[model samples]
Target: MFTVIEEQEQRLLEIRRALHRHPELAYQEKQTSALIGKELDRLGISYAAGLAGGTGIRAELGKGTGPCVALRADMDALPVLEETGLDFASQQSGVMHACGHDGHTAMLLGAAELLARSTVLDEIGGRAALLFQPAEEAGNGAEAMIADNCLQDVEMIFCGHIDTHHPVGHLAVDQGLICSYADPFLIEICGRGGHAARPHEAVDAVVVGASLVLNIQTMVSRMINPARPGVITVGRIAAGAVHNVIAGRAVLEGTIRSTHPDTREQIIRRMQGVVRGLEEMCRAEISFTLHRGLPAVVNDPVSCALARQAAREVVGADQVISQGFPSLGGEDFSFYQQKIPGTMIRFGAAKDPSAGPAHSGSFDFDEKVLACGSRWLATVAVYGLRYLQKS
Candidate 1:
């Protein structure tokens, strides 16, 4: 079973390195999409090109009339300069695959090739769809693909991400709530401007902004239940221009994350109340804008069990971790789960202590996990299709 992917491990490594060397950002994945299309063509797999009205690719493989299972890989890179010092570091300036999307794409392609050659489709009852998505870092790629009807007729879907927190060859399978809700917000406070020396003339926008920042922090500590996990982080703040003049306006940008739906709603309501209170107390006109990002990724129990069984077969039961902690980070893969039963597994790729976390400039992982991931994805697709058919 593993020999299929083992034979192509070196090729997968080379492809991942090539993608790492020429990372592309968000919707600008022209070269990346072209490479994927060319690979699909080489495998004789027909796929829809330019999906999501952009650079998303979708390929289906099978001959039987069975339930359709889908496998997804995000193909966007971040705007971080490479500092890994590896020979195949990013060639594109200010762009890098710090989140392991390069490896994700390569592994999915490897699975596609393996399934293309195997008789799993004949044995099972349905086909498998390979979804190469773009712009996950920008946070709308999954929604775009769903809008394009990518999940049509798809009964079950599976995706995986490389995690440096776990050792190589390990798999983390969460049965429910694998990720948190991520909502970004911006607050602009406008006030009267005056001389810095004046003590009582200006409305003091800077003072109001600073106070609002502290007050909003209480949303997590004071407003919500401490037992439930929630966070409100102010990532950026910009205000005054010069040292002598009092600024008339200030801006605050941050993100809110929560695991539960009721908790998330409570946080939003409290945030709005805080903003209103600040406006009334500081005597400044304030506007708050919240752009809801990805929702929490909740795994379907049956699908998660199928994936875990596949992982146990590929890497042994000892290596399959079923009790790993969930992450606060967001994944757009949640979008597909909203429509169909879906699960996203975490592949252990941390080779050494030197490997940094995801989205970091020095992020890199063990290449051995590529083959393991490829085999796991292919096996899970087969099992998932059969399971969905039975259900």
Candidate 2:
């Protein structure tokens, strides 16, 4: 399988570059979806396009005699302008594949090619579902796909991401709690508007909002468990229109990250307490709202072991390592895991120590890891199917 993937390495790179050139954002991945459909057609694999709001494609391979396993790849790009001066930089304005989704899509397509040519499915008497998903960056792609019955018969699933934190040829696989539960929050501080010079007439909303921001920071530090990782970052604040007048409204926007459910609840409750206290003290009406995002990606132990085995086969035994700490970053893959067992593997794509980080316009990865990623995806799907059949 690795040999076949290596033989098509150049083709995979070309696909990746083409995706990088014509990047799309969220549900607007028309060209990307069309490209994937065309490739699946060329491979003679059966698939359903126009899924998940017309941008997701579900392709199938192998005989449907046993448990089904899924292999997923996100196909959306970030809303970032290209800064990397590569010849194949994004042609789409203000849109770029800065998070290596292009590479992920290419590798999965390569894996599709491999699985289509091999007899592994016939041997295991199972099927592999290739989920070409969109809108992962917007954090609801998996949910949309699930609603469309993408995991209708999937017993287990496997996916991978490109990471510049590690060198090429390495794979990071950890058993549980690999990602954080991310939630975005907004707070509106409403006060009475009056003359700025009148010391006692106006209830200054900016001052109240600033106080709430500072207090919100303590929800993670002073309220949450010290051992459990948690963080609250206030990224945006909109308040006041004029300099001389006391503004009546202030809006604060931020995000929350927690690893455990109990911790997440505790933080929210504590935030409510803080908001109530600030409202009472400032004599202002404060509204706090939290928009729930993705849950922490907790990998099943059985699935993790299978992924590690596949990584060892694709890379080397020594190159397969545990992801040391859980990431505060969130992934929509957790939505799929809520229904079935799934594991997310991270492939090292760093060319050097100075490799740019993900979600940045300057981000670029070493293309050599494309073959390794495809091999691991294909191997894990086969291994997972065999395990599911026996269990």
Pick by TM-score: which candidate is best? 1
lDDT of 2 by residue, 161-243 (tens): 99988888999999999999999999999998888899489999989988988887766677778888889888899988888
Model 2 misplaced stretches (Cα beyond 4 Å): 4-7
Instruction: Output the TM-score of candidate 1.
Output: 0.96
Full-model lDDT, candidate 2: 0.91
For each candidate, the alpha-carbon lDDT, in order, equals: 0.89, 0.91
